[model samples]
Target: MSRLKEAQKSSKGAAAYSRYINRPLGRPMAATAYALRMTPTQVTIVSAVFTLTGVALIALLPPTVWSSILIAVLLVLGYALDSADGQLARLTGTGSLAGEWLDHFFDSIKLATIHLAVLVCWFRFFDLPDGWLLVPLVFAASANVFFFGIIAADFLRRVHRLEHPHGPAEAPREAWRSGGLYSLAVIPTDYGFLCLVFALLWWQPVFVGIYTALAVINVLMLLLAALRWYRSIRGLAADV
Candidate 1:
């Protein structure tokens, strides 16, 4: 297989847009990174630079036709680079615990700050009811919760596996999440889709409508996921 094909990750539980679009976009970028002898950590820093720059732009500049598109492009590129770092690590056998930590650290910062940047942008530029300003605040809280929940759940699962190496595998339960319908159903939660949404930032009303819809969907999804994750974690504790 080609290097790009070899670097591909399983798309089983990934959102539709991420599985179909972002990963594919990252493949060539990963290949390029590998060819350049770049470390995964370096690539991750580059991702952070792109992402943070876009976030800064959102807060610092009034949206314009051109600026909105630039923001979208920067975000999209940043997200693709986020995927590329992992692929590069996997391809080059350079994966390390520190590298993983750095990746998640940048991601946590991104998750915590992106919506705050939106809140800042709206405060500075958009003319809306004061009550409407709460949207990004709520969304920011939800995003952080979602990000932390996933990380915590994964850590707990790893600990459980270490404790019970021969326990029943999780594949059966995970199978449902791997399905195409599950992937499609979660597209609203995909960061790649959110990056694309920034392209409409110049249209304040449309942006607010879609952003509100996304915020609502994220809260609902996070609630459902929290319940499931709680049950799973409780079960793991019981098994210990």
Candidate 2:
């Protein structure tokens, strides 16, 4: 099967088993908005607003288990908004260079703020053991490092492709599947999910452990991507 087909199949299977109940609802709304002539950039901006509000709410809310639950709901809404923006952009043919840049910019802000808000809540409202704040900060920093590395690697890959048009082209199918995985590398959504889990479990330490592991994996993936880009460029130069 082509890489695209394989990726579609994999994604379909994942969606089938996903615990995210809002996915189905999100798609139709995205489609409808696209049909209504809304640009992806608009949707992305809206999503960012929601995300910022959610973070602010979390930080300012009174300390209680219900507050955590409310934050989790907001996180889920933010996720849906994130998905909708991209989908709407693609469906409406409103994708652009500016839109892409804006998407990444807002995404970085959203990710950083979410964790920052959580850390604030933990420090100000709840009393955790000493050095607990460091856990979230470390995880956030590690995630940002990996995110930056991936962006650099992607830029390198594009340059390599431009330099060598015929140098053992990546299987379009594998490229598609890998593209999804690489997208995951960009956002560290897993880290956000871990934060939510930690909030629910009240196990701040365990959340740190999970985020640390994910950061390591993300860094490794970035390294692999960089290596691939280097090899592709080298192969192109050799051909020349």
Candidate 3:
């Protein structure tokens, strides 16, 4: 297989920006890291640095059209690097529990704090009413829950598979094959979409409207997703 093909993972439930844009960007970065003989842990740290830097910028800098664009670039680059680390691990055959733990640790930190950074920016910079602050606060909470729920679901699936090795295997998911419409449908839950939304930070009304809408949509999606995941996980026990 070509290096890119070898590094590619199943898209499965990934949202549009990640499935289509970030993973492709990361593939070449993963190749470059492999050529440099970099470890996945190192790439992970670098990814965290870029991501945290962007988070800090949102909290510290006054959001301008230019600064917002720069923030988007940094966050997007960080996200690509996040993708690259896993691909690099696959390429080098160096994937490990520690590496996965570290990757998820950083992701948890990012998911927990990125929206809080927005909260800080809104408080420190935006001239909004006090009630508006709740948007980011609620967003931050839901985002962390969303992130943890996903990882927990995956962990449970892994354990279920190990426990049921002799039982029937799972049917392969067909979500990715549905292509464009499914991808488009999940855009609100995509981090890359949120990153791009920062580009409108110069216009507070527009930014707030879009951001608030996304938060509401994500919260609703998370509720529905959690229920669906619960049903699926319960089925694993029933099948056994």
TM-score of 2: 0.70
At residue 184, what lDDT does model 3 achieve?
80
Query: Which pairs clash (backbone N, Cα, C closer than 3 Å) in model 3?
Result: none
lDDT of 1 by residue, 153-218 (tens): 999899889989988676345788889999999989999999999999999999999999999999
Best by lDDT: 1
| Pairs with steric clashes in candidate 2 | 3-173, 4-173
Give candidate 2 misplaced runs (Cα > 4 Å).
1-25, 171-192, 195-240
Worst 10 residues of 2 by lDDT: 1-10
> Candidate 2: lDDT over CA atoms?
0.60
Reference-based TM-score of each model: 0.96, 0.70, 0.96
Candidate 1 Cα errors over 4 Å, as ranges: none
Each candidate's clash count = 0, 2, 0
Give the per-residue lDDT of model 2 (tens digit) for 10-119. Answer: 34212221223344435765766666777777777777776787778767876456766776666666666676776666555567888879888987886677667767
Against the correct fold, how does model 3 do in TM-score?
A: 0.96
RMSD of each: 1.3, 5.7, 1.5
Q: Where is model 3 more than 4 Å wrong at Cα?
A: 174-178
lDDT of 3 by residue, 161-229 (tens): 898889878766775645777888999999988988988987899999999999999999999989978
